[model samples]
Target: MQEASAINKEHDKPPQITRGFWLTALLILMFIANPLTAFAYFTSPDVIVSVHPKATIGIVYFFGVMSTINFAIAVGIWCWKKWAVYGMYLSVAIAFVINIYLGVGILGALFGLVGGLVIFLTTRNRWQWFN
Candidate 1:
């Protein structure tokens, strides 16, 4: 019976898009963005244009804080925290739409769109998992 139990564990269902995939994606994004932003500043700020300057600076700050927080939440969710997973759901959805609305660039929007698709595709069918 003990041997059977161990064999059953080995055959347990595989993770749907294992958390490592998302976390690695977020890390790669963070790495790529830093150098890309700097290079854009030096080489040509015009390559990837967005909306014009605004008075509040709220948009800039919102983008910055969310990126960092999202990274943390990605890591946390990968570790299997329920709250972090929920936050990952809410934050990614809100950020995707808000970024699109706030004039964030296309590549960034693509990342959000893919992230949303990943989450939705993996979880949407699991009705019981949400609660």
Candidate 2:
């Protein structure tokens, strides 16, 4: 009877995270891209053609700072810090709204969106972490 209970408890544990391990790694990688793209967008206008160079640079700067913050949160999440999970969600949501409003066309933002979802979804069931 005890053995059966132990087996049941083991089965109840969240699926061991093997499936999302790659997604988790990808999310970590996404954090690195945040600053890279932001810098590129900021510098690209200096050497490249754009309808609104100044405006683009300024917008990129804004995203750059935000991305830095998001990247930090990603690291925090990687280390199993609880706030990183939820704080990042809020941060990404804000970034998404701002990026969409500004008409930004960087792929990193999409990765952030998907990566945030992956972390939040994967860890959502683990209440102990939240505490």
Cα lDDT of all candidates, in order? 0.58, 0.67
- Alpha-carbon runs more than 4 Å astray in model 1: 1-51, 54-56, 103-111, 122-131
Write one digit per residue (lDDT tens) for candidate 1, span 18-129: 4345545754664566355444444443333334443135545555566566666655545555565677678777777776675667678668767656655554444343
Query: In each prediction, how many residue pairs overlap at the backbone (N, C-alpha, C within less than 3 A)?
Result: 0, 0
Task: Report the lDDT tens digits of candidate 2 across residue range 44-131.
Answer: 6454336434345566667667767777876776666788778878877877776565555567457548766777677776636453
TM-score of 1: 0.50
Give the lowest summed-lDDT range of ten residues in model 2.
45-54
**Model 2 error, position 128 (Å):** 1.6
Which residue runs does candidate 2 get wrong by more than 4 Å? 1-23, 45-56, 104-112
Q: What RMSD, rounded to one decimal, does every model reach?
A: 6.3, 4.9
Best TM-score goes to which candidate? 2
Best by lDDT: 2
